[model samples]
Target: MARRALLSEAWWQQATIIPDNEREIAKHYTLDRSDLELIMRQNKAANRLGLACVLATLRYPGRPLADGEVLPAGVLRFLARQIGAPWESLQYYPLRDFWRDGKQMISA
Candidate 1:
């Protein structure tokens, strides 16, 4: 028989378990000046917020964000407030190449 996976599917989907509490959210998801500069370089509001989420995922959960992954609401609110975008305006974020591209660029 094949060996069972050690980590849960949720671990593959980083940012899946980010805490929703205000202090924990701020601790893990706050965008710093460099992060803000990078996020601001993205073309549009949605892209900025999307990139921020990806960056946070890479930093905390230390893995690539899975497609269609839903981030914790507190994390979203923290990033959105920093990027000055509405938290509900991530219309262009879902499963988009923008996220993968940003992930690649950031990793590079």
Candidate 2:
């Protein structure tokens, strides 16, 4: 299994301001864009990957689904649509849970 890594202190620097730096990030992960960017500025490319890692970890479920089949919802689907991919589909699948978690479903 691919282990989820934590975001390094540097990711705060490189993170683009999305919604607000406070409500969107700090309230949850206790770290914000500034914090992440600072870490990135102090580190290198490999360290930047921590941005995605930390975000994913911070966004990790409050609890694993009892059925283990909880899929992305409508909002996420719409976002995915914007990111159109040949394999994209309306079906739901956690990034890590296609075959192991449930049936594979795709959307476009």
Query: TM-score, each model?
Result: 0.69, 0.22
Clashing residue pairs in candidate 1, if any?
Answer: none
RMSD of 2: 15.0
Clashes of 2: 17
Off by over 4 Å in 1: 1-16, 95-108
- Which of the numbered candidates is closest to the native, going by highest TM-score? 1
Instruction: Provide the overall lDDT of each model, using Cα atoms, as 2-decimal numbers.
Output: 0.78, 0.36
Cα displacement (Å) at residue 103, model 1 = 25
Q: Which segments of candidate 2 are over 4 A away from where they belong?
A: 1-32, 62-108
lDDT of 2 at 80: 31
Query: Model 1 over residues 8-95: C-alpha lDDT tens digits?
Result: 8886555346677888888888877998989898877888988998899888877665666788887888889999999877877654
lDDT tens per residue, model 2, 50-78 = 33333433354332223434233432332
- Evaluate model 2: give its lDDT: 0.36
Residue 21 local lDDT, model 1: 86
